[model samples]
Target: MPAPPRNILASTDLHDVRWLRSSYSTGANNCVETARPRSGPETGLLAVRDSKNPAGPALLFSAGSWAGFLTAL
Candidate 1:
């Protein structure tokens, strides 16, 4: 068996992250996805999870923080 993915949040209330599909996803193979809250003033707190793991869990990051992460990649 493979190793489990590392949990990103130890005590985050994931109820607030609103998931959204990438308009560019092909929906046939592995594709990248993203999500954010529907309404909020929270800073640097965007939620992200794997598309294949809807029932699993998610990682939380600030909007700016997440942006910086992506930028680094």
Candidate 2:
């Protein structure tokens, strides 16, 4: 089996990543934004951070895990 994805201590650690918000989000800053690291150790993981706090910690998820999570929602 593959290893599980890990969480990043800070979203700022991911330099040069473009975080995107959901189209369903209002401009209220109450939602989360997601980004994919194109290179480095974070590559292949989905990075998620709170829109309310851009420099805060980000949670990382494997692509398959993220897909499963969305499917269950």
Candidate 3:
């Protein structure tokens, strides 16, 4: 199989996707944000970005990888 992509796409360019913040987070933009792109190349992948930089680049991860990270945390 081919390798997964590892590119930092600008979060602002990911249009029409709803960015998610943790419920426990203050509205002060001091935490991380996540999103799921329903269309385009990002589809089926989880996108993460710093809430402090909405227009910054985002890191992508597979669902299983994200889950393992949470479990290891």
Which number leads on lDDT? 2
- Candidate 1, residues 1-73, lDDT tens digits: the string is 4432333442234456566777777777365445655443332356676777666566666667777998999
lDDT by residue for model 2 (13-43), tens? 9987999999999989999999998877788
What global local distance difference test value does model 2 have?
0.90
The segments of candidate 2 whose C-alpha lies over 4 angstroms from its true place after superposition are: 1-5
Per-candidate total of colliding backbone pairs: 3, 0, 0
> Which candidate has the top score in TM-score?
2
Candidate rank order under lDDT: 2, 3, 1
TM-score of 2: 0.90
Question: How does model 3 score by TM-score?
Answer: 0.87
Q: Which residue pairs clash in candidate 1? A: 44-62, 44-63, 45-62
Candidate 3: C-alpha lDDT? 0.85
Off by over 4 Å in 1: 1-13, 38-44
